[model samples]
Target: FFAGNGNFYTFVVTATTNGVVNINIPAGVAIDYQGNLNTASNQLSRTFGNEYPVYTSSNSGGTISPVSASVGQGLTTSFTVVPYSGYTMTVSGCGGSLVGNTYTTGAIVAICTVTATFTQIATAVLPTVTTGAATSINMNFATGNGNITNIGNQVNSKRGIVYDTSSHALPGNVAPASSSYPNKVEEIGSFNTGAFTENITGLTSNTTYYMRAYSYNSVGYSYGGEVSFTTNIYPTVTLSGYRIFSNINTLNVGTALEAQNTAHVFSNSGDSFRLRFLLHIANSNLSVNGGVFKIQYSLRSGTCDTSFTGESYTDITSDTPVAFYRNFFSNDQVLLTTNANDPTHNSDTVVPQTYVEKNNFSNAIATVPMGQDAEWDVSLFDKSVMDSTSYCVRIIKSDGSLLSGYTVIPEFTTATYKSRGGGGGSMYIENIATPGGTTTGGGSGSGSGSYLTKCSDGIDNDGDNKIDALDPECHAGGTLQGAYVPSNDSETVAPALPTGGCTQNCGGGGGGGDLGYWIRTVYGIFGSQFLRNSMMGSVIVSFR
Candidate 1:
């Protein structure tokens, strides 16, 4: 039978046994309006059966458990999708539902195909971090800072600064604990981001160190840029040199007393001595400017000895020690003058005025320079009430608070001079001139005679070229008036003169007549007895 419409045809066939089926259309069976005939077609046949064909397919990323299958008509079939590692899969072509890795089609009315696909999965990456600069660096410690800009795909397990004396670069794809870095500070329970700080201690002084900020995650460790810093050095103060002046005049004359032990003597109960110190300061750590220098003394009752034992004595505190010279400047240098009271008169006699009278001198503190040796003069003692007592002195430095880490070259010991009663005596002189032509005697006698003492006589008894008050051994109480006569014939030994020539008058005395006028004028202008005396000598030579 055939039923047809315009260019359409239908055929029906029925089978009764379960067997294979083939279908084909023969040529010339149909024709178009143009009268074109179709080619011959093969025969067609079919065997009715209960099963229908099921097909399956997949993309490159995955595979199907079953390539193909057959099911009864109006029944369902399924295919398992197996995706490779780091990949995913999906199915299409057949109307299907997926559960887990399995793809199942709806009831198969005829043959249909199911497809599977796979895609690669993404992997987590390492975190990102940066190191900040070091701060508050000191001799033994410093502060380090860092920041974590990104936490990446995983939470940071730890974050902090890592430091070492030598630098260590962060390795890629390596965990912080497995890295070669020697030291690290991990902030426990700090898995978040942002800035952080750690205090690094036990560092060596004057040493350079490198540091970095780090963060750790499941992927690996991340480190910030590297930073480096150096610790500060400690400061030091050292005593370079020291000298003793027998009296104020010796100090003014730039003479240093070298005798030690009992050989160094203070003849009178009212005599005072001076101690000069040279200090060398180094390093910028100490606050030397506007700092205080102190001289501490211990007094004991006994004969002066190298070892002071068994004699208990009291420390002197009535008079504070001060610099002998005035006008101490910024560099710790002093303007040394022969005469402190009268600046106009040039003389070798030097004495520091009382601290209360000089506004320029610091009563309780002294200013010293850094990185050099500074000269300091301190009035040690006055023997007025210190009979049969021995004393020793040491120095200390301070800046608001006391300073340490200093060494004195030669440790201080007990005093070399022992004070004894009746060491003072008076002498009589025949005549003394008072800057005028008139002559007077100590006992109301008027004739000049050989009875003049060595200190007051017009002759140079020691042949050291210095006469009377001009000689340091004269000990005329820093004046040329011929007062304070010596008790014995043995003259007090004066220390060797310093390298520089006298800056002020080397001798003290009154003047008279035209010579006196010349002396006064020259002394007033030059402030140097050496200059006045030299000019006078030149005048005398010209006259001769």
Candidate 2:
């Protein structure tokens, strides 16, 4: 017998043999009321002694427990249903109710079928990222920035910047390791989907670098567009101050000569001179490289001006400055001392024999490594002539560029010595007691010690009311002696002798009556000696 309801059809067959029977349906053998042709069905085999017919289940994108089972008429059965990852399940054709992952048949009377359907689950895609331009770029460090618009389906395991000296392709779908890309920086705190920053360090100065922002997750890494930035040049070198040494004496002690017109006096021609320039490095990671030093000088007829703008000078080439390489000492070790020894003393070696000359300017008299706050010393011989010489220094880099401003040069003057004739003599009058209880004779003078010279003496020997250094003749005659002293040694002259009788005592408590006797007594002693020296052809009388 055959019966049907819409697309559901059933057939009942009576068993006549005790053996099994097989049934098969070919493709397009049957048609539904909606004019849809039936597809091929699997062969069904049944034993005649079985209690009920077989129910069959099939699935796509999923699986079901108990794919086939024999059930009694008017009874129910259940099966476990499972769907693949990223899919969902459903049952049809077998009139069943599904709760959770279990599906139960409504009553089975004949052979039926169960089908499980699954559709893919929608998921999030890769994240969107952007790379920002470099900020706060300097000699050794810079800041990198990035933003993550979306984080994708997985949490980011790593996020930061990747940089290199050369341009490169985008990173692969994995976090880049140091071996593959050497320069990388990661944020220190918690990961953020929005804007973030990474402080990149250990960079080289005056170099161009390429970079990109990147983010990583289970789906792999995502990168922003490439960007480039060049670091700034090394920090500018500076001159802190300077030291001028005339042998062991420090000329500019306790004062900065650059701000004043302090004089450096040279005592003798045999003395050696040196200059120590205090150099400073503004940044700890930077250094002043190989460079040459030059000393410029000008001869001034009068006093030197306090500032460099008031004078013109030429570079010194006759006594060329020599650059030295100090072997073992650091900058702080040599510069911090009150009086640093000359660098040429022991472990120092002259680097190059001569410095570079350009445009008639002997730019490099000495070469120095001004890597830190150090004493950059140069040697100079003493001046032979008496002149007021002004000096300044200039520094040049290896590329012939000026480092900074010139060092201030003070006016240095040579000392003067007194000159006298061959046959000069000095007359001494001792034991002369003045009314003021002070003695004056063969000594410096009353109330004055050896500091009193003929020009500084208080006497008006020249008969001009102006006495000692105040006298015009004292300063007008010879060369200037020192920074503040007059050069004329013979400016003072003896006063005229008394003609009338001594109105005062002539020593020994004698009055006017004993004046003639005392005068002859003084004449008899010194007069004969003066006559004999006069006959010998030369006589110079100096009375004190």
Candidate 3:
């Protein structure tokens, strides 16, 4: 024993008995204590089987995995605790302290308590769903707003998005399952203090989705408030046929038609020069209101203004894709018989037969939906090219956006063949003439003259609307049915029908004969090539 006043002190006591011992020190024996030594009178002894510094360990709120510890003198025993899900651990009570999740006992001879106190885990705050796109979406989340405040035992954290056709609430056990891509919830790994975003793909197009962001911790998931979005949809389109008009279509009227086969384009000024197409609309359900019917010309025998840079359509596997909308003109277009009585023929009814057409010619649009036909018309503002260029048509979206691939081409043409009597569907003078008629039309080229097929111009030549061929007075005895030769020409006796065709062949001298028979001989002289050049005015036609 050592005291603060360092005086020499010594004690020696021989054992009276081996198993037990008793010691008695007088009251004045220790001055520091100022009393007798009580411990010298009594004693306790240990004779157990395991005696050299025995050690033990334990914990609460969690499990110490290897609780059965070694009891060795100066030997360290390692102990680990297994926390239940959200539970954590703490070591105390005598033996050892915990480093991380492990507890190593100190050099000791006593048992100790390793307490593992478990509490709920706090996950991140609910996430925010930012945007939704075709087949994918963007979601975000953050920490610090979770339900579980126990940050000490946060084993792990993750962020991600959850979505479905319907609503999904927080703390839910079930989530949406899509047959589409990314069939499950997307989870981003743990992050601190910053934003988190995850883009999930394979979402369906044009579908509305309910979505939210989510955070997870050792405890459970915390969700962001609900959000939703829908994708955009584009409709399909298709076209069928178109109608032509030389004049305004009367309003509220059913089916106003103009030239179907042979539409005219006279090269002279102050002549009828108007035409517009009313295309039949189909698939109105897909009316994106983003399309137009554009027509480009391919001119020939007909004359055009010099500055005209004719359009050329290319790139198709077969024929080039020209701007031909609706049904096209075919060879079936015969010479249009100028019949003033024809309901479809309006050039005759239009006042001031010499009045020039300078206005755009088109009709009111009709509703074109599926299972029903409607009209989308194009006003042919420029007419010089139509006289020769053939047409071709195709379907294109209003925005000119692609559908699958190439534009589908339909049958189309603008070649006006000569009809039997200038019939409604007959070709304009461009591709027609009576076998021996002195007029050639169409790509065959044209001939200029007032020397029309005198009998078929459909004009009341002598000041009457009752045209020739049909008017009884126009039969032979009327004013000259031949080309109107200026009255100043000398009168010549009408010659007999010589041999075959020529009854009146002028020999360069200014003379007049039966103009009807004069033109027949003109037919024999010029043939078909000379016939195509005929560009007479105030044309009319009869319809079936």
Give the TM-score of each candidate.
0.27, 0.30, 0.23
Query: How many residue-pair clashes does candidate 3 contain?
Result: 44
Instruction: State the C-alpha lDDT per candidate.
Output: 0.49, 0.49, 0.34
Model 2, runs deviating above 4 Å: 1-127, 178-181, 233-544
Off-target runs (Cα >4 Å) in candidate 1 are 1-124, 173-177, 237-282, 286-544
Residues 1-544 of candidate 3 have per-residue lDDT tens digits of 4334434335555554332243445444454444333233234332223323323344344677564554543445677766667655556643667888777766645544444455545444333222222233211111111122222234335655666666545534223342221233554555443444554444443456666655555555445555666533322333323334432222111223443533343322111112222233233222322233333333322222222234233322111112111112221112222223222212212110111111111111222333433232332222112323443333333234323222222222343322212211212211123323332122212222232333333223455433332233433222232223222121222112325332221111122122222332222222324322331221111111
Model 2: per-residue lDDT, tens digit, 1-544? 1226445555677888654678887767667666666667789776565345545556567888787777755667888888898787777655788999888887776688776777666575667689999998866678998998788855676788999999887765667672246688875344548988888887878899988888876677788888899986665555444455543222222222222223566553223344455444444323222223444555653444334455555555422221121211223112223332322212323222221112122112233332434344443443223322333444444344555543433345543422211122222212122223222212121121122244533345567654333344543322111111222345553222224442121111111112122222222222335334432321121232
What lDDT score goes with residue 166 in model 3?
A: 66
Tens digits of per-residue lDDT for model 1 on 206-263? Answer: 8899988888887877888889999866445554444565433332523445432122
Q: Relative to the unseen true structure, what is the C-alpha lDDT of residue 297 in candidate 2, on a scale of 0 to 100?
A: 54
Span of ten consecutive residues with least summed lDDT in model 1: 506-515
